[model samples]
Target: MNFRRFKIGYRTLKTAVGASIAMLIAMFLNLDYYSSAFILTVLCIQPTKRKSVRAVYSRIIASIIGVGFAFVFFEGISYHPLVFGLILILFIPTLVSLKFQDGFVSSVVILLHLFDSKELTWSLLWNEAQLMAVGFGVALLVNIYMPSIEKDLKSFRLEIESLYSKIFHEIAFYLRNGDSDWDGKELVEASEVIEKGKALAYQDVENHLNRRQNLYYLYFDMREQQFEIIERVLPKITALPVNISHCYIVADFMEELADHVHSGNTANKFISKLDEVKEEFAKMPLPKDHENFLAMAALYQFIEEMDQYLHIKRSFVGFNMKKKTASKES
Candidate 1:
């Protein structure tokens, strides 16, 4: 296998091995009560450096809440199976909706099992909490020693870059060859990738919510805005009566523009292409009627705005800043 592919496989193996070792150690200590909680809390959490810590916090909090509820109920009622069943009905759904509900549920069950005993008291709660701490500590080891956030983010960025390249290629083909069929397919495919990209990017943000400098959130939000702008342009571009050659040329320009943006660089090629497209519009023979002129004018307007969006992207990381300048112009 290639180097990158081998690294991915190696990482997966390392994670599996680490988690297995953790499981065995927990089991040997008879800490099965917290085994599920540890895995679920850590697994559902995004694989970020921060989440390793937050997962511990969330698990601990949820455990306390669950055990607290169990203790209250058990103290109030005797250990009747029917009462336990009823409590289950009420508590299960409530726990499931919680952010770290999986861990909480396990904790509540442990509490219920130990309920109504004379041994039940703050001391027992402390003991359970300590065991949970051990489990959480184990999970943290896996996260720290076998972290994959850097690898995950790099992979995600590569996928986005690849998709951007394909989108530009499709656009170019349509513009240069006037191949409506291929351009249509390309646009559809690119849209699908954009949807997928948005989902992945959002996941990246959620994984890092507890971190201090969450640049992933900013990057994801920026991509979302760009997705919106492109969506608006796709239909307009498709509807234009121009031949495949014009479409491909425009697409080629867009591809180059997208590359510049992806690299976080200025879109000089995009600006030049915008002017070229404008000249094309101006030189085209007109129907000499008001509505036709209006339609042509609208097309130019869209292109100009799209160009402005690209320019704004070149200047900063978000639409919020661009809005200020647009307001100033008005």
Candidate 2:
């Protein structure tokens, strides 16, 4: 395996701490099933505390199901290999159909332990309950404080905006010069960056239980939309039949737009600038030949893309940016 990519995170520390604490407490209390506490702790810890929170309920429910099935199998039927098979046949399908499949493996292990008990009794069922409480309780307390993703989210934002600026600068250079050294590798980088950013942004949102809004997600969403337009628009830029003098007007506009990609504010200025370009296009002579026709069509499409891109930025202006409200103020 690639241990080179492995780095211990806060979540790992949390899980370890929680499991150790649960085990210690169980040992002190001298519970009949002390191992269950540690087992529960290991199962409950999630990469994100929110995930732990969500999974806890399922773990509890699945434990109940497993214990319940074990009780029925031990008492209703004989404790034979065939009975265990019958229990699985009923248990697996029922859990799946209920959409509680996440607990299936854990529940199976739990049932196996109960199956090997010295005697089937109410105390056995009570022991399982104690394990569940210890495990789920430790997980809940440990996950109360989630680590912040603000720093990482900021890095993604800066990188995304920087990439946008580079792409726009390249596009303008290509439009005017009809050539560029850049191969659009940044599109691939941007895709990975944005996908990761959106996921982290979502985790950031999940960390805050009461806050429903997600600014970073919206920010990435806007960039993702712009990314789509840019991929479509970039290739056509080099093919325009116009020279530098003809492309100069749009070139200057693009460079100016590039400067403001990270502004994250109202886009009135951008909208007005695009309107001016559209007006200029309106007065220009219509394309008669195929080459000019394609160039003109590309120009029109580029304008529309820019307009939509600017609007997406505008949509998140007053909302959260990087998990904080007052993005416009920023």
Candidate 3:
């Protein structure tokens, strides 16, 4: 069995290895305060690559600023309670103004070193820089070996498609038989699955430098929008008193649509197909009976919902295509 499928595998193991390596490197170099390297590595490991990069950027800057401020404050002013308070007042505002607040906690750690050492010397400052470099650098290198997310992305896509297929099939069955076995729980499951899938896709984006838009993210978003319409469609399906002629028509259409959920069919083609259905229905006589009228009304509402779902799906495709074309041209 693939052990990495568990939560405590590759990522956590890599983090531990990275921290150990950082400390080893620091010891080999004979740097003072070598444990700082291990500490920094632990703090730097993040859920997404983008977050790790941001953390490193802000912390490095914050550490440098911290060292400089502490050196000046300790040497130029008396190291009294009032002086420390004054330094914090100035330093906190400076970090906020520079938009480096993400590093505030790290900066405090940097300040603590100055407080304990009481030696404002170049040698001590160099040690701080060395630890930050070795720690963050090792962490970055280890994180770069991220496993291929393509497989996971495809898995999520298939899951979402399956959910959509089930929903459509259920709708078709309901229209055809005037009864449905579907518990409507797939709607909830689909929402949860899409949201989780989107989060993973975002992490994939963070792993790449040149990634503009993740197709899986777009795919999940399209599914999520359609999910809302599906919610509306189900109620209308259940509200009709009895099956009408249009109900059979819609049942057949939904069944056909379910077969093509993962077919990569163009949204425009579906839109065109819907136009034909609308036109064909327009040529028929209006419903004469109260039961037929109710069923026809529900069928019309269902068609509108399906049309909206298709359009939303189309919007993602069209927008992403234009983006890719522009990227290629540039």
Candidate 4:
């Protein structure tokens, strides 16, 4: 058996522990329908702390509202089957209107308890409230310490940068030699890495209640934008009709850019070097034939795209600062 494939994730472990604790506490309190606490804990456990907190809050509020509806319909009117069905019709909408739909299942559980007991006594209400507190409270407590995904985020960042480096190097090689055996696998790999990185970064953002933005997320987003530009210009670079002096110039710049593909903010210097290349290209004589003219145009468009790519990196504020902070932390 491949036990490695069955490796439990942190969130799963937390959910299990939380559910166990919630059930034990509910049982200790002698709450009726104590097993429901286990279900509540499982339902309330979320991947991110903010989500878990929100889930708990919603479930608590929804349970309270459920109790209220039960009191009005069952106690004031009658605990008949028609009244039960009617209460559900109105209860669901009320929870939805209050934005507590996440708690619908847990609230329904409470309603079932009331229906089973066939009573709206004060003791039963207190028992249900205690169950909610134990279940959701345990879930909230368990989720308070979300394991940091910083290491995974950093690994993805490094993988993306390495892939980008290889891609740029391949482009430079093709531009210089007018032929490359490169299979362009790095392009696809980089795309996948960027997508995964963005997802992980977004999860990190959700992990923190107060954090509005994650720097790693912004970094991946910037890289995604740059990757699009790279994809756009790749065919243009490869399909140049003739290898000219300007192509070599751009190739050399690309090699230099490849070497500097770290999490640093050095795009400004490259942009300056690129401008020099542009000036050099301008001084060359006009292309002598249509093929050469098309080649020159393609090279020019490639340079413009490279400029956009560098500008995207430059516009990513605080990237270098975050890099430094990460370095110090390491």
Work out the TM-score per prediction.
Answer: 0.63, 0.90, 0.87, 0.92
lDDT of prediction 3: 0.81
Error of 4 at 255 (Å): 1.0
Candidate 4: misplaced stretches above 4 Å? 1-4, 319-330
- For model 1, what is the alpha-carbon lDDT of residue 189? 53
- Candidate 2 lDDT (Cα, 0 to 1): 0.78
**Best-performing candidate as measured by TM-score:** 4
Clashes of each: 10, 0, 0, 0
Compared with the true structure, model 1 gives a TM-score of 0.63
lDDT of 1: 0.55
Give lDDT for model 4: 0.88
lDDT of 1 by residue, 201-316 (tens): 45454445454333444444454566577667655655555442334445656666556545434455566678888788667687466655554654665677677666655544
**lDDT on C-alpha atoms for all candidate structures:** 0.55, 0.78, 0.81, 0.88
Q: Whose TM-score is higher: candidate 2's or candidate 3's?
A: 2
Residue 143, candidate 4: alpha-carbon lDDT: 87
Rank order (by lDDT, best first): 4, 3, 2, 1
